[model samples]
Target chain A: MDRNIAGVTIQVNEEGYLTNFAQWNTAIGDALAAEADLALTPRHWEVLNYLQTEFKNDSPLSIRKIGKSGVVDIKEFYQLFPTAPLKTASKIAGIPKPASCI
Target chain B: MKRILILGAGTAGTMMANHLHKELSPNQWEIDIIDEQEEHYYQPGYLFLPFDIYEPEDIIKPIRDFIPHGVNLLIEKIDRIVPREQYVQMENGDRLRYDILIIATGTKIAPEETEGMQGEEWKKSVFDFYTFNGSLDLRNKLREWQGGRLVVHVTEMPIKCPVAPLEFAFLADSYFKNKHIRDKVEITYVTPLSGAFTKPKATTALQHLLDEKHIHVETDFAIERVDNENKMIVDYGGREIPFDLLVTVPTNKGDDLIARSGLGDDLNFVPTDKGTLQSKAWQNIFVLGDATNIAASKAVSVAHFEAEILTENIKRFIAGEPLNAEFDGHANCFVETGNGKALLIDFNYTHEPVEGTFPLPGVGPLRLLKESRLNHMGKLAFRWIYWNMLLKGTHIPFVSTHMQEAGKEFA
Candidate 1:
């Protein structure tokens, strides 16, 4: 699926997560965050950068991992994204939602 | 003779011992399995123990009962694994070298990972069914207790038998209703995931069941601490769910031996090649089951399937042949949905469980992703197979090592 974010066409999944990380930019991230009713601050960008780094390295993301990443604590991460922090942060950061192996 | 050392005589290690003992010539190769414990536990039975459906004796047997006669069984504690030197250091100051090493020291629930989980209210108001003692204790607790708020929770993701907590909630509903206290008891399921399960199709089916059973669900809750004083679990987002009885699957981690040996990740799970089941750090060492940091579900079915592939890979390594990357993360599980019915699901790395016929495909005696009494019977019958056939590395009839796409509804 494609969505116009920040005046740019970006590929996204049904859940509104960016499918292609290569096409992600700050403007698109701002727009995605805005859609979720979040205003991205510098601290939010730090956590977003950490999530993107972990995604690029092919490391699985988890709330526990994010808590231990030294970038932000889990409480602040939750407060920043407000709901489903990992899912929302992944969307704003242009990555896939962290899935649990079932 | 060349030596093959297997760590932990649990499900995966026991099956590997049997498979290798039959496959490798005894004259050319020797196999040894080690574990500190004496009893072989039927881990799945832990689910029924809290419901008083299975007796303690039914799930436990001497570990020696499953070990093959020709294979060596060592009841000794391992201090550490010296992977670079291809040897293991025993706690008693004995060092054993191996030509090949298989680590199946499975994962265990660590209640201490969360603050206040193991505190003053540890086994009193709070409990876990992931262990034999925990389940037995909970059984006793549920026997005499009047109904109140019952919270079945998962502290984090990637826990073993991921559906067990939900199953616990469902069973509690039936249990309370049977006791004629259904109205008095409020059952709530708390999870870290966004829905009733991980996969899309299965989650939809299970969430509907939750609604039908009248079990309240609290999703996307990443717990931070258990407030024992207030009898409430507080999440990172500051959401609090109070409970009279808290049954939580705490953080699951690999054996502490992995940590002491410095061979684990942040959660003490070993890093291994998911396809080959070989340790990424050491070529001679292999890992499977809950110990490895794989994306596969940490379930017995997965270990059963991996045992078949690991046996072949071990043989290839001995013959100087390239290893076969054939393991597809296949797992077949029967989810007990209470009221004497269950749902059977078969899936792999690429496929989420969907509606289909299993084992026999279109002619299945078992249906997939739908509740049925036949599926419940299959789950009960699995106990016999686990002890008699599965541990002996026998291939289950009609069940393939890989997931089949036939008879499945994809779209």
Candidate 2:
């Protein structure tokens, strides 16, 4: 479904994760972060950029991978995005949430 | 004569061996399967081992029993694979060349990867059911144990038989109730995932079971370390879950040989084409089962389905035909929900397990995603099927290699 964020319509899933990265922009990301009650910090942008790069390269994201990414440790990641950091971060970063394959 | 070298004589490798042996002429091609272990274990039995429902003899057999007559079963330790040179280096300084390589090395639990996991408590207070020794030891522990806070935890994702830990928790509930100590025992399930399971619909169904069973859940918990002194698992966010006894599925990784050969990802899992089962780095090398970093459940059933498609693909590769991208990650599993009831789940890459009737579809022999005694019987009967039909590459009657969507109710 399409959701209006930051005065722009963007494609998102039921869980509010972005279905298309092409429609993602800084305004939409800022609005998503604002909805999650997070203020965009330079550190948060670095992690977002890292996540976007991983998404572009078609690499799956995990807390362990992010911890080892040297861009952010898992503890800081949790502090930044708070509860369910990976999911929340993925939402704001405009990427699909990491899927745990069954 | 050209040769096909298969690594790891486990379920996937053995199936591939049997399939290729019948397809390729003995005079024209040679098949060799290698594994250091002498015993072939029915790994699913590990879930029942801790509950004392299955005996060690029921799950173990001679590895040689499964190998075909024409195929050479070499019990030798592998040093590394020289992919560029197309040969495997054995530990004894022996090298075996191959025209094509099939890697089925599979995954193993690495408890040492976590901090304080292998500490003073090790097998005494903390245990893992993913290994034969661990399951047996846990069985012994459960035999005489007094009830207390029991924590069943999963350290990371992509563990072999991902549902086994949850099954352990369910069985533990039944076991405690049978012992008349259900009220005394506090059972808690800890996982890194956001819910009781990975899929939404299945998670809802399983979450209902967990609620009905009164199993406490701790989700979105990324474990950082196990504090032996406190008898608790500390997450990266500093959330600590205390326990009297901890049963954990530790970090699972592909064989070290993959790392030694410098042919794996960060977790030592080989990157393979998800659909084709061909190694991304080398075309001649094909991978299946838990060895490849595919987005499929690392279950025997998945391997069974892959064996069918991979067999055809292997023949195609040999015949100078285009390889079939047919492996759809089909995995059929029986979730033992305890108390003589089980749930049958059939799914593939594009589809999530949903409510339906399986095999016969609308006619119904087994119901999918719903608890029933018939499914429980199917789960029990699977042991015989695993040993006889599954291992021998015999096609299981009525079951298709790909996911069937006909009888399924997809929302």
TM-score of each: 0.95, 0.96
Cα lDDT tens digits, model 2, B52-140, are 89999999999999998999999999999999999999999999999999999999999888899998888888999999999999999
Q: What's the lDDT for residue B199 in model 2?
A: 74
Off by over 4 Å in 2: A7-11, A20-26, A53-60, A99-102
Question: Tens digits of per-residue lDDT for model 1 on B53-74?
Answer: 8999999999999999999999
Per-residue alpha-carbon lDDT of model 1 for A1-102, expressed as tens digits? Answer: 888879889888667877789999999989888889999999999999999987775566779879998899887887888868988898899987766543
**CA lDDT of every candidate:** 0.90, 0.90
Clash count per candidate? 0, 0
Report the lDDT of model 2 for residue B176: 95
**Candidate 2 collision pairs:** none
lDDT of 2 by residue, A1-102 (tens): 888889889888767888889999999989999999999999999999999997775556678778888899888999899978888899999987766543
Q: For candidate 1, report its TM-score.
A: 0.95
